[model samples]
Target: MAQAGEQAVGIDFGTSTSLLAVGSGVGPVDIAPLGRTTRSFPSIAGYQQGNLLVGEAAENLPIAQVIRSVKRAITDCSETMEISDEHGTRRVDVDEVIVALLAEIGTRAKAAGRPLDTREQVRLGCPAMWDGAQRQRLLDHAQNAGLPVAHSTLIDEPIAAGVAWVRHRYLQYGEQVEGRLLVFDMGGGTLDIAVLDVVGGPHPEISVLSALGVQLAGDRLDTAIAGEITEELAGQGIRLDGLPEAKTVEALVLREARTAKIQLTTQARHRIVFRGLARTQLPILTYTREQLEECFRPQMDQAIGLVWAALRAAKLTELGGHAPDKLRGMNGDRLAADIDYVLLAGGMSRVPYVERRIGELFPNAMIYDAAGVAADELIVAGLADPVGYDRLNLHRPGFDFVLEYTESGRKITEKIYPAYTPFYSPEEAWTNSYLGFERRGDDFPGPKRGEGVLRVRSTSGDYLALRYDGETKHGLRLQLGWNMLFKIYCDGQILITDGARQTRKLRVHQWPVVRGNGHAELVLQRVDDAPPVPSTAWYLEKEYAPPGL
Candidate 1:
């Protein structure tokens, strides 16, 4: 159990930077690496023969030995990476390196006064395409590190992102929401879109329409710009791609270049010093925005094309020709083509051109009204909030996710969490409701008693009421924090089971009462001798109430 004020944080491990946030009301409140401008440690890790170095300290090692882009290796299983420092080179498994990074993050979490890993509450975001094996390996690695990892879930980056966008715009610090919406998550590695039908008649129907995992992102555009610089430098009779030494110098020069590339989109032109390995003073490289856009224009178009694909899927979701129609969420009616709104997320979303391109392609939709951020950060924030999904559902057109598998070494398609049921509840925090993936009905396994996944994201001193799909069962509450005598209850069974922050002298309703109706009553249960909050909640469709409620 976690402290009452604690948050089940969401971690976004990106190629360039990684971040963590707790609950929605307060914030991700950046956890800085020691002695920096409150910036996160670079994902880069450096190994000096025997010792290990992570973040800025690791930069001391030669660039080659300092593994900077660990995100690239998450998908591949049979990959072996080697880094060398003058004296010798060593080999490390990619997953091991990833774990090392996570261990450092755990350290960061402890420093922040919120140790999610130690507390066993955290939702991890992964590329949408990460498979069972990939997810399993990453989860194993996380568990190995003292990540508290009590309940670690693999959320697709895009979906996590979509969830975030929803929070940014709709969820008020102290409130409950109801509705349908859309989430667009474009990040350093991929672009994802979801149309959520949040759960409940008004608040829980968070069904995902589709999650499109794009292979291209900021890195691709950066590479295109780098390629152009190389070509231009080569034409200047400066061979940046010729000799190995020359390539090294060129790589280093471009090191400070992409930041400039991103800057160029907003700034007219950025200055650059291209060095020459052959002629000590001759290979200096310089650049301008015109040259960048000329080279990266194709990649930019590709990104726009991908966004179009997402919009098309969203259209299908609204129309219900898709599997979601079977869910019959949208009043048994199809939505209009012109969507209500479109929200943006991820670091790349900050790129001036990205919004422009998105606007051009998806003129029918308006960008989320929330403050903009790196494409990935939005999702990180959303994940921190319990009501993140609810906000989007209430504010936007709607979102959805399409599940897929591969056969004969090829990708297969399936619509598991259709857009019609976006906010559907899960069994345990460890379970995913894509029944086929992690759960099943009574037909296959044990009698399918209600396995409810009631997740509520929030910040400190904040209270929430969640009604799941069952009758009032016994009440259950697990509090790692204060022990309040009276908490909130719903249907007179489950108790809110946490903080007395809002318990008023006048407002008796403010007491932690489990609020709402569902198939299973959401109750905080005292399975054992635990008090304050029970270990869990059970909503009973039949007859279920607390011992004395």
Candidate 2:
């Protein structure tokens, strides 16, 4: 239970929109209104006359002056955007734009009587495919915006949605209801899927078996539909090529395509009006659900294929095998039968095609969406609830941590920790291995007579090198441990009482893509001819503690 006077705030800083929710003690969470009648703020920012406008104010700005989907740039720290106004044109760092948007959100939430003070518990949701560097960048941005957030408070978006479902079920049944749930979250920029196993009772337990994501969602679908519209215009002798306002016309078409897509979700047909074309008066374009489905078929097929991939990942991990051939005998029937419920989340999940296809894939699973809960608010609702703050076990990292070094003129790679292992379980905390430094023959040609280099690498492409003295006759005993705060540390020591020991902590990085073509290396400074290994404190203070503290 949460302490009295304590508040839990969940901020869903999404690519299309941002939302805020607050919960106190055991009460139901409430979504704070950012405008007179809307609870969401558009995730966009615009520059005008040396001033910045955010949310609804920025939505009306010219496409060239406004930056949409600013959250997607966090993956690349060096990304920049150019925005021009009547005054002049300037280039701005993407991080700066994100910070401004977050600060504005904080201001609006405060004006709505839900200020995010340092004393209140706050959590931010991120895409499941984000690596440690991306996550850290978001945490820093939230801090700069004056939000009460820390590393431990960051929750995966799909997992947060699952938490919302679990809490809603608990309330509906007046008791805990146990089952297996598969959460499908397809938002503006990405599609995240998580398989969760739940045990219901007064104290519910939720474990994420596997999680996966891909950069395919509502935004891509809009682009496809817009392309189809462009073809139609080209056939009508309305060519936009070489036109003065070509970019503007393209943007207008995309905007109309997005609007039409949303309308087609609940309507059979929608009419898109195109006005202000240079010297051309075009006829009103009518788009139907059938045409939309034609444009969506390829993307929808890929999306459903990804769902099967996620389920296969979970099954293979449960079987404790890493080889691809391990799944030769497995089929979809057993996996589909195991899923008791399929929870749809995110704005894209509202599409009727998505629901119908998912229902076909999981024949025996119940497709669930809480009666009154909006798809966009699911993540925030779960984030604000204290019930899942302490009981939800996140999915283990999907990549392995390895040690790479040269031995006898050959490169040797040893796995220190395998993927899909419980990160928080005490039984899997410590991993022990031996680091041999023997120069068996001249062919071995080890590092220098007094120096050696050992590189610790994660499959996701982040690595750190350790330089140590090679004079010790006995090999070093290497111990790697996953700490409670989701960090990995390495301790190397000679087998003697007074032997010198070196300890280094490496932050774990995981992602679906290989970052920078495996060039993301952490360089350590050398001190007195040896690399310095600083010890980090593993304890959390009262204010920095995670939820349920």
Candidate 3:
């Protein structure tokens, strides 16, 4: 529960479950639980009879009608899926399902006593690998769902987890831990890994060095283990047949396998007994922790491969002064000697085998066991600012600003913010264009305002348009004619004459706009009667201001 004044709510809408956390500007972040289940809520929605239900209330619905893992569905860029129920079959877009789920969460949160009335104060977490279009679609859906998220921004899943990890350490130790960290987040449906550099202080600073994600996780593990159970049952007298019957049996096996997976964390073996699956009796089944580990071995190997790949990409594997011959069979302990902590987040981290493998890899570093960050409330905690949390000082942007126009009667596209440029604050100054690998030196100009000029030359055409392939806040158009020269200054203040001199409310694009690529393109051509008012111009320059001002 949150104390009254201007509460900042952070929602971890997971694939299998969701959680909400609330905090004021300068206090400890509190977990807002759903009913009596502490902080966890089933990330499921169902339509039964004439009523729609979500979270725990919707968990027991028929599989055909229940929408689960809608986050992953939307991330796949899917449009819709047809589901039949008492209301008949109809197509529902992934976005619509996500909206419904979020709306339900909103209602539940309010009823639970954490008011998220201010849109700007809410932070939502998204997958790390999502592109610009996906991020925008989510925002659009959230808005349409009637979520007041005026100041809402998307956070990378792993980054959010890292933020929580650091905060917990700070509160417990009263000392800021400074060093690099490798965040491994293995949830029910997805695994996201990111390397972040943490700087502890009264105001902590976290920088994401690199990240990677995979679609396979606990769901796949559960299926693989369930397959083994079904094979054993098929060997006996009882066996499931037909689509409907098989699905029912499959669902039951999955549920049991999931339970076994959790039980294997503590006990040596777990029994999988099903009596009425598909209306058939089954012999009691038992699986040991070793067998369950075997089921997840392949996925664990994949997770290892991803971790190695990320470390290699981040250059952590480079033994600067060591001999080349010694690098032959380098393991994680040697490769990540500089990393102070290996933090684990997500429910799957609770598995003893999973922890053992991660421990083997980071033998030299203290691995944060993720008991404190299991629900991923850290992302919103990181967004909280006792000083100025709502301001765009935190949170990474997920889009690349692309400058596109026509040249020689052919369209050309240029990537302004190259992918290699590390995540930076919106107010950070730009030096040497921050050209990713093309950077000449290691000097990074600190936080300061920056400006760039776009020279529009009318070589042979009179039509030019500026476009960004990602979501935009607002667009601005200005024209400089011979008689009345339209002068745009480095400062964001615009001096436009509609009829009188007045400054209209302007919305620059989303936060942390890449400063090096901060310029707009347009065409300079004479029109027959260009209006002197703000409208009717050749083209305009669009800029992104720091959000939540």
- Local distance difference test, each candidate: 0.49, 0.66, 0.57
Tens-digit lDDT track of model 1 for 357-392: 666654455566243345546666655655443322
Which tens-of-lDDT digit does each residue in 103-174 have in candidate 2?
A: 988999999998898677788999887766777789889999888787557788998888877777766566
- Pick the winner on TM-score between candidates 2 and 3: 2
Positional deviation of residue 439's Cα in model 2 after best superposition, in angstroms: 21
Please tell me which predicted candidate would have the highest lDDT against the true structure: 2
Q: Predict model 3's lDDT versus the native.
A: 0.57
Q: Runs in model 2 with CA error above 4 Å?
A: 1-6, 25-27, 75-78, 82-91, 276-280, 319-323, 397-549
Ranking by TM-score: 2, 3, 1
* Residue 67 accuracy (lDDT) in model 1: 77
Q: What TM-score goes with each of the models?
A: 0.63, 0.73, 0.69
* Model 3 deviation from the true structure expressed as Cα RMSD, one decimal place: 13.3
Q: Give the 10-residue window scoring lowest on summed lDDT in candidate 2.
A: 490-499
Candidate numbers, best lDDT first, in rank order = 2, 3, 1
Backbone clashes in model 3, listed as residue pairs: 119-148, 119-149, 119-150, 120-151, 164-378, 509-544
- Give the C-alpha miss distance for residue 494 in model 3, angstroms: 29
